[model samples]
Target: MSARPGGWRRRWILLLAFLTPPCRRIVALGSRELDGAAAPWDRWRIRVHRSICTGCRRYLQQLEILREAAHGSTDRPPPTTRLSTESRDRLKRRLRCEPAKS
Candidate 1:
């Protein structure tokens, strides 16, 4: 059999079609990534993503269980509430954008 001009193009098109993921899967993966120790707003975004993407619902449930376990552990303070004085000073300095005036 002789190859046509479009034969290679057709193979590439098929490959691309196979590699493309469904929109719901993409959203699910994004939600999974954002569910781990992310900010509150990021967690909210993951929740919203999960609401629309049922494929990720199980992943979200797993994340929620993990988060609960982490919270139950008393070994460390919550990330949102724990800040060293040095860190606080650095943030203040960055926000002020200038050395202390006096």
Candidate 2:
């Protein structure tokens, strides 16, 4: 172990990380926002989390795409709406690569 143990900078980083919600929670918050059921705190958390996490940013984009498709369906005939194989695989890969929660 280093003598400094990362000092104050590292301490702050760890503290911020601890405060930040994990990817799973962020995803849930994003979904809630999409549904207009999110609290103000949730919106702030989602905004902050997405700024640092590419996987979650992509996931939210995918969610938006799905939402728009769902809304469009209400105006017309409803067919099976599904992600394309590539999108599904990409999403899976991103989720898999994310760091696990403590």
TM-score of each: 0.27, 0.55
Top lDDT prediction, candidate number: 2
What tens digits encode model 2's per-residue C-alpha lDDT throughout 1-102?
Answer: 665855976666566557779999999888889889999988987887776678998999999898889879767753556667999999999999999998
Clashes counted in candidate 1 amount to: 0
Q: Check candidate 1 and list the clashing pairs.
A: none
Worst 10 residues of 2 by lDDT: 74-83
Q: Please estimate how well model 1 matches the true structure, expressed as its whole-model Cα lDDT.
A: 0.63
Off by over 4 Å in 1: 1-36, 63-102
Give the Å shift of residue 71 in candidate 2: 2.6
lDDT of 1 by residue, 5-100 (tens): 899877775564455455465455555565554556545555555555465667667767877887787776668778889999999989798666
Which candidate has the top score in TM-score?
2
Candidate 1: residue 36 lDDT (0-100): 53
Global lDDT for candidate 2? 0.83
